[model samples]
Target: MTETPGASGAPSVRLTAGDAEVTILPAAGCRIASLRVGGLELLRQGDHYGCFPMVPWCGRTAQGRFRNGGVTHQLPINAAPHAIHGTGRDVAWDRLPSLEENEAVFSYELAEPWPYPGRVVQSFELTPDSLRLTMGVETADDSFPAQAGWHPWFRRNLGGEDVAVDFSPVWQEERGADHLPTGDRIEPRPGPWDDCFGMPDGVDVALTWPEQLRLRVTSPTPWVVVYDEQPEAVCVEPQSGPPNGLNTCPRLVTKIDPLEITASFTWERLG
Candidate 1:
């Protein structure tokens, strides 16, 4: 494991496994400062999901108006009038004890009276071969709705090369221009893709580089969202819900007395 100085100038922990180098910021709620695998970086800077990356509402919130539990909630537009991700990414997190060298646990509580009333705990682990991230959220009320996912920015390399990705299952199509799902799915042909996908168990997603480097992501989650803005990097986000999930799955809007959700991804380098 390697160590680096954090934004606070204090000693922060950094772990290097094979071609992956991860920096853990304990003071900043144990946020993942950087995650690079096979020389490809994922997880955008200044972007987080409270501790990881918040989904359900990734990107914009659409004027910050959405229905929840048959009631409409007006969320502040952090990025314009859109909700943009969730509250967890911007909130502070507390560090927890762990025995794994590359494992980190963070905890946060949104009291009953808090803006986003829910208790959440997140864990991030990076191995020499892969990365595993998980999150659990519990609420005091049995009616609060929640969605979770990771937002990592991946590098496309310096030579401006196109990376190819392979998924086990077909891709899901979006219902609207806002990138919401239409409850319909399709196979990924040669075209622009910016939507969630349903992956089969133990499915392998590979990022083949022109420089002869291959990065792979294997996970239990059935859905993966491939996001790219060109010339920067691609994001292969594994999510429990599609973008604008509340609008897509109204039943998921209800609050939970105590809810727990877990999602993970593994990254490895190929010869």
Candidate 2:
């Protein structure tokens, strides 16, 4: 995992308020390269390892295919059998003006491999206790299905205790052997999970590093995918929809209205 500097020769953007600090890489998928609270880094180190915006779509679009208005469109399969994440994460975004130093915005226009003309905007804002992430997508012409979310790879250990994940999901999306949901809802199972969970009341998950810190990840989105199989990090992702949502639960982004979603991570020192 490498942490990339901003576009060209530009340095990454850093925002500080109180004891919290945030580093963002606009050229590297507009991911949060580093997040520190109470003088301890919460996110896993590296460029591709930090939290990144998953826009237009989240997770995988099964077999890289979807239908809009009765027309079938195929996406470039970057994750073998499916298109993982989205095109937004693989391109450099253009920075937009912000009235405050603690907040920055970046935008990218959809291009080839996407089969649409649209714009995606991602914003990162930091306060003393939390970091807020907002994402939106609006099509330039035709209406299209879309989704937005965040994938944050937080460190399992905070140099003290390994982080513990806690959350109550309404149900789990039964995963098929191919790794896509089987369209069946079942009881939430025990980890190590690489599955998506339902939280119709909204997503609220906690990560605790005993005697170190506690972070609460919250979002109004009803879907979340938790991946804890990795030895070094734990991911708590909040999404606007489920994986393969393009085919099963499409959220339309049109010229009149755009699809938008937001998530936040708030933390407190613990003993």
Candidate 3:
């Protein structure tokens, strides 16, 4: 692991494992600066992982209005017409006291002035074994239910046409039009995949490379959304709740009347 100074005086943290080297920007929302395995960039730069937000981002209702506990509370859509990843990703975080050279922790308070009144802290630690990312979200108000997760873009060799993912459990099929759940479970088959899988009791899932590398993600989140945009890239997102879980399935939402939610993901390279 190596520490360097990033642009605008941000702390640049770097970690190397097998054939991957990952860099994280602690000040710019702790976003991933770079992810390269075997000298190949997996996270698309100038496209994704920019100075946007910290990981374990949050998603509220488009209008910040949802029915909870038989009451409807309105929330302002920070991003007009759509509720985007919560404030943690966009806000500057406070660097915490550290003891490990390969690890970095950042904390931020999402107050009532914001659309959502919550406190979120994210930590990114790189070691000789793998890269560990963790996030914790807590709310001062007890009535708001929030959802959060990671949206990482994994590097894939699309030209080989042999890239495939081995999911841990059956996934709920989504309506082609709205991309929401259809309440039906189906097995993995051929063709394009843009669906979320309800993770079933597993610490790790394998993503096999055609000829070069195999990546495994060990996460505490119970679901993983796999998106395969042909000729673009593959995104295997580890999420705490299902997509549109708040709007569609009310039970999946995390209730925080003084609420707290935590999730993590660990990535390791295997040859």
Candidate 4:
């Protein structure tokens, strides 16, 4: 895989705080390659990276089809039968110039198949115990529907300890056979879920690995999708909207206002 510079000329970026460390790859969709807190790895590091940025839109768009301003746009179905995780994960992002050791930013512009002219900015702020992620999308010439978020695939176990999830979302969005929300919000069900959920207040989830580590995920957004079907990893995604949200609850980014969201993951050593 090709690598990108941390700034204008640096090959890569690494942030360190206490025993915590983070590696950001600007070329690989500006994704987080690794997030290690002490001797424990909190993220699942692999070909997809530990975490990736989902921009312009989060999740699927219903068979890769959506209508805006009377124009129908079709996106490439990267996830089979649907366009998933937005195009940001498949494109190159420009690393913004910054001198901070614990912060990095990357930017990307909308291109073909998206049928929109806009720019997306993603930033990461790292501390001794947490990583704050922020994303924003905006169009200068026209208003375009958009969403933003992160997909962090966390390891199911840490230091040989099984992971446990704890959260209380307001409702679960019943998923259809195609994995799209059915527009029905029912009581939250027990995982392994690959569905979106309503968080009337905000997104807050805690994951604990007994005798290993404890971590908390928080976002101000009202929607979150939790996927725990995998034996190796679990995903607790926070986003501005849900799957097929373009047709359900579209958030338009105009010349004056942009769609922006922020989420933070804090971890602590246990045992």
Candidate 5:
């Protein structure tokens, strides 16, 4: 366990077991800043390193507008015409009291543009062979809507070996001009996909770096977005809902039933 000094004075925690090490930033959106196996790094460090959690709502909200209980709420357009990801990643997270070396927990309260008074909690647990992540949202007042997930920008190559994605999705959600899902489910399409897919049984994606490392990402959610447009990095996002799920298929979060989701990324050394 360790902490790094930053501008915001945010503390970074590092967990090491055997030849594996993982670093996380609790203040900076509670993101995993780095993950290394043996001596090789698997996740990309672009602008922000490793992966970050998406809470309150995952992905984007079309035009940043959504209707709830006969009222239309408009969110900030962080990504031009839409609100990509959620406000959680752009704000600081409060660290929760914990004494474990391999485990850390952080929480963020709902704020403006979200229109809901709630709280999101994210927890990370790391071991020698795998990393488990869990996210949840709850409100004391009325029921609202929410979603959660992780956006991991994986390195395209590991030890000079190119990475290849392998997954069997039932259908792909057709994309529109603005990159939003068009509500049409088509057959499994080709690679270089920046679209969402429907995995009825759940989301299970295998990213293989040839003979170096092969990581499997699994989640209970039925939606996953695969973006491999760039040659430097590929993103396999395990989201609770699609890009425009708020407007397409909103999942109500009641006082008794808060939205919760969990996902894991486990890897093995390839021969």
Candidate 6:
């Protein structure tokens, strides 16, 4: 399928299968504006960022405030003192008609500086090499704390070479000095990273473009961040907690508990 004119005007959506292609923008925040595989182009061609979707709360929620029970809420710093990646990629998304053509669905609504009152629902499925993603956050009345993830900029050089980031991660959240996450957990530090990693047996990672393609990002969500210092692009981010995690590991999204997360990338091609 295909369309154009999105980013609030609504329309963008493309998907193929065998040789893989994707280009969903559903009003921009449904992001993933391109992901060609055999024909190359692994993301990062931009409309701000290629693969985005980090709702309710995902990374950095420190100075932007948090605390739900007694009420704290602040937000809106927009990555200066914290409060990065949330507000659902900065709004606009609501596509859901799905007859199936690689699967798609989107939704949004979690207003203000996000004091509560939620909705966020995302889904995509694409498959040729793989791309499944899913996200959630709900609140019929209100509860609070939330998180979800996927922030793939990718593309560190896909002409062949310059994308190496494999992962094992068991610990490593020691990042502070305003980068947030200093609850300490250290040990896997090395990357040209922005920090945060812990696998709990999920959240796998790998980017490798040594000869061509290799993307493997998986995620049952145990947390992941890994920014590659950016010469161009390379972020892993599978987040669902960590990075102030709504004032340190919280995760309640009322109306009968709703706050889900998922990620999957899967790829292969090297020669």
- The 0-to-1 C-alpha lDDT of every candidate, in the order given, reads 0.61, 0.89, 0.59, 0.85, 0.86, 0.83
Name every residue pair that clashes in candidate 2.
Answer: 2-47, 3-47
Model 4 scores a C-alpha lDDT of 0.85
What is the C-alpha lDDT profile of model 3 across 160-264, one tens digit per residue?
Answer: 544566665655555445455566667755546677776667335666766655667667666666767755556666666665555655532234333233333
TM for every model, in the order presented, reads: 0.78, 0.96, 0.76, 0.94, 0.95, 0.36
Residue 47 CA error for candidate 6 (Å)?
A: 36
Q: Please give, for residues 1-271, the per-residue lDDT of candidate 1 as tens digits.
A: 5457776685567777677778777555456777766675654565342124663344445666666656777777666635667666655667677788777777777642224555677777777666677776665555555566666666656344667766655666554655566667777644456667776563356777655466676556565677765556677776656666656643243343343445444543444
- Tens digit of per-residue lDDT, candidate 4, span 1-271: 1244654464666777788888887777878878888866778977575899888788988888887788878888888899998888877789886677678888998888678888889888889899999998989687878888999999998657679999999999999999999888899989889989888789999999998888899999989999999899989999999998887888888888988899999988777
Q: Which ten contiguous residues of candidate 2 have the minimum total lDDT?
A: 1-10
RMSD of every candidate to native, in Å, equals: 3.9, 2.7, 4.1, 3.0, 1.5, 13.7
Summarize candidate 5's per-residue lDDT along 1-271 as a digit string, tens digits. Answer: 6677644466787777778888787777888878899989888984464798887777878898888879888988988899888877777788787677887788988878678888898888888899999999998687877778899989998766789899999999999999999889999889888999999899999999887889999999999999999888899999989998888888998888988899999999986
Model 6, residue 97: distance off in Å is: 6.4
lDDT, candidate 2, equals 0.89
Candidate 6 global lDDT: 0.83
Better of 2 and 3 by TM-score: 2
For candidate 3, which ten residues in a row score worst on lDDT? 252-261
Order the candidates by lDDT, highest first.
2, 5, 4, 6, 1, 3
Q: Write the per-residue lDDT of candidate 6 for residues 89-174, one digit (tens) a residue.
A: 76778887878878888898888878767788898888899989888889969688888888889889977568888889899988
> What lDDT, from 0 to 1, does candidate 5 have?
0.86
